[model samples]
Target: MLTVIMASRNGAGWLKETLDAFAALHPPEGGWKLVVVDNGSTDRTSAVVRGFQQRLPLTALHQARPGKNAALNLALEEAEGDLVVFTDDDVLPDPDWLLQLRQAAADFPDTGVFGGRIDPCWPRPPARWITDLVPLGLVYSLTVEREDGPCDPQWIWGPNMMVRSALLEGGHRFDEEVGPDGTMAYRMGSETTFTKELAAQGARCRHVARARVRHMIRPFQMKRSWILGRAFRAGRGYWEPEPERVAILGVPRHILREVGEAAGRWAVARLRGNARERFRAAWDLNFWRGVLHEAWINRARPKRRADASRPGARDRTALSAGPD
Candidate 1:
């Protein structure tokens, strides 16, 4: 049996579409179990899940403590399937998602973790340059066609990943301190840590292109402020362990470089067409904002050596020092 776990927070708008996609993936012999973890959504997210409960074999778990990891852990505790699949509420899986995953796992019995592609479902048509400027998770659509073999482990994107239950029971789970939680501190990297730990434990992890999902890219994300904010936060998460002197000097240095590059592009675009340049400027600015916000928060609450020994210390440090 396959258990699909989705950790959601105020994702009412897109929950139905995701659930519908899952329902479409149901096997004719025996359908998969769907578990939705409602992470303290103020909107009608719970109600939306309730509507789908009758049509599908769904279970809703409520985690009042806010955080994507917290909600994921809650679902993990209750997951009863031999295989566990994780995805986000905003992502719509392909019709053959489960079928492809099952086939991939069967082909490689030793595989512990398998991830698919995620293409952005942009609200409006975006300039081609925007794809280059912003990271669109992994380019699974293009990479999936290669021959099946062991590849170097890259960072994991949350939208589309599947892991076996034995892997979690053997003591691997999502890091609870980070991930998007309504603040500028959008925490990430838990997926990266989880996959690395799986590899370290001698478990095989692979990626199959057949299993794919369309990530709904919101209009708000296209804005210049949001793009820069995301970029800065990502930078802060990457470089959190350095001394204050290093961080203080490094923050503006990177931001200035990005700003200069964006300005140069914008200047060239003035003579040519401005569409690509404008989008690049927007992404760069937003990324810088996220980085600066992360730096400011880090400066405000410097991490003590004692705090570094906690359960989620690395992630906490990353969230505090930078964007996720």
Candidate 2:
């Protein structure tokens, strides 16, 4: 058996559709169960999940903690089965999603991490301006074309990811700071940091092209402000400060210079460039601003990675949504 786990907060509108899609999934051998953690949602999220109880071998858990990573870490505690699949509540899995993943896991017993394909489906086609400015596939966790073989663990997006349950049960955890909290503003690349650390520690990784999910790109996410904000969050999420590099106000000199250069280019583009060119430049500018913001915030604080910072995280039996 395998466990499919995800977290949702006030996402009831999409949760129904995601569960409906799960109902259509073709069960893999040895069976599977779903574990969804409600991260303090005030909406009908619990009701929606309960409706799918008969359809899936469902286990509902609740984490009052604010962040997505915090919720996911809770699910990790209750998840059974040898393979643990991680996905989002806003995605539609293909019928063979779990089947392919299980087959891949069986074939590659050496691989500790597995990333599946994610295809983004929007309510309506986006305009050329935004399309040209954003890397749709990269930004939306869409398709990353490549052969089914060994790949970087960092390439695994949260929407379609899997790993050995034993690995997580062995104390590997999601860093609460990197994922979505109960807010409009937050950092991106929620799981990449965890995977990067896993790879560095010698966990073999693979990309299974057949296991797929379609991530719904919400309308609000298509807005310009959201896109710009994502650039900033990605900037903060993606930055890796050089330990040996000298810094002023916690930001390295080269990064500060890059910020200046980005601003100048954006100004020039705004004055003379076309719509796409201008937005692209603005995107770069927002990215550097995010990088600078993260650098400044962490400059004075001692560096430490801890999941216990999430409220009540030390309690193993606190999941409020009941057992499987």
Candidate that scores best on lDDT: 2
* Candidate 2 per-residue lDDT over residues 190-217, each given as its tens digit: 6776776677667888999899898888
Score candidate 2 by TM-score against the native: 0.90
Give TM-scores for every candidate, taking all chains together and pairing residue i with residue i. Answer: 0.77, 0.90
- Candidate 1: Cα lDDT at 312: 26
Clashes found in each candidate (C-alpha, N, C closer than 3 A):
18, 0
Cα distance off (Å), candidate 2, residue 289: 0.6
lDDT of 1 at 296: 59
Superposed model 1: Cα runs more than 4 Å off: 28-31, 138-149, 243-324
Q: Which pairs clash (backbone N, Cα, C closer than 3 Å) in model 2?
A: none
Which stretches of candidate 2 lie above 4 Å from their native place?
Answer: 302-324
Q: In order, what lDDT does every prediction score?
A: 0.65, 0.77
Candidate 1 lDDT over residue span 43-133, tens digit each: 9999999999878779999998888788988888778767888888887778888888878878889888887766667799975655665
